[model samples]
Target: MRTVRIWAEHSPFDLKDELKKRGYRWSSGDEGRPKGWYVDIDEALEADEVRYLSEHIYRRDVDLFTQIITPFERYSVRA
Candidate 1:
């Protein structure tokens, strides 16, 4: 599986329709920064899918807090 990070100042839901249009699956992040979502693309997804995902998911002005990490990698949740 491949991972991509997306950031937007507004509601992450803003991109939901586009995601659905492009056939990408997503999951919400854990506590704290709940406004963000993680988009997971199947390794088998086509190049067009990846390109569309990168183009439409982000807003121009917002600082997107994102990182491309593997599913097996560990991330700490700070309180």
Candidate 2:
């Protein structure tokens, strides 16, 4: 599966709902040592779905986070 490493400071605001729509979960897994949030783009997602998740949704929101801080750090993941 293809995986994209999203920087902790680049996460979107609606990350929880958006990722849920795509059937994938996010995790920092101790990425950046708690400096910020980080999520991965997994290959398990359908090819088309990946674009929506990354470019349209993830990337789009990330572009906005360039100004915010805490909003970029908050996220919920699967247990």
Candidate 3:
């Protein structure tokens, strides 16, 4: 199954607990990536995952865009 790594430009500190509760893990800026929390989910869950994340991230009311990082993963940016 394909997996997708999800993360954002800024670490949503306010959502830390919720994120952890949902199984997201912290990444310490390894390999040029930004420091933040991330979760890898099956590609099939992309829509729901994006919806949930977009609702709680900073500036929740605005639409966001995705920057494809790979065939199976991407970085989310605020619109």
Candidate 4:
């Protein structure tokens, strides 16, 4: 499985909806941040597709990290 880290200026709820439309699942994570979100993708999905959607379609700013680690020090992904 592959994971991607994405940052968004929109609320989490809105971002989740946008992600769903793109065929990505919103794994639950830190909810306090107003503009941060994360999602997991199957390894089979094309990396370029993920980048394009995250960069253009979703239009939410994101950091592409190979690891599944969260970018923020204080924020933790909720189980």
**TM-score against truth, every candidate:** 0.38, 0.33, 0.66, 0.34
Cα deviation of 73 in candidate 4 (Å)?
Answer: 19
RMSD (Cα, Å) for all candidates, in order, is 5.9, 10.4, 7.5, 6.9
Provide the clash count, candidate 4.
0
70: Cα error in model 2, Å: 35
Model 3 local distance difference test score: 0.67
Residue-wise C-alpha lDDT for candidate 1, range 1-79, written one tens digit per residue: 6665443324366667766564444445445444544444444543444454446655323444555657655355544
Tell me the whole-model lDDT of each prediction, alpha carbons only.
0.48, 0.45, 0.67, 0.50
User: Between which residue pairs do clashes occur in model 2?
Assistant: 8-37
lDDT tens digits by residue: candidate 3, 18-56: 888888888898777667777777878877877887777
**Residue ranges of candidate 3 with Cα displaced over 4 Å:** 59-79
For model 1, the run of ten residues with the poorest summed lDDT:
58-67
Better of 3 and 4 by lDDT: 3
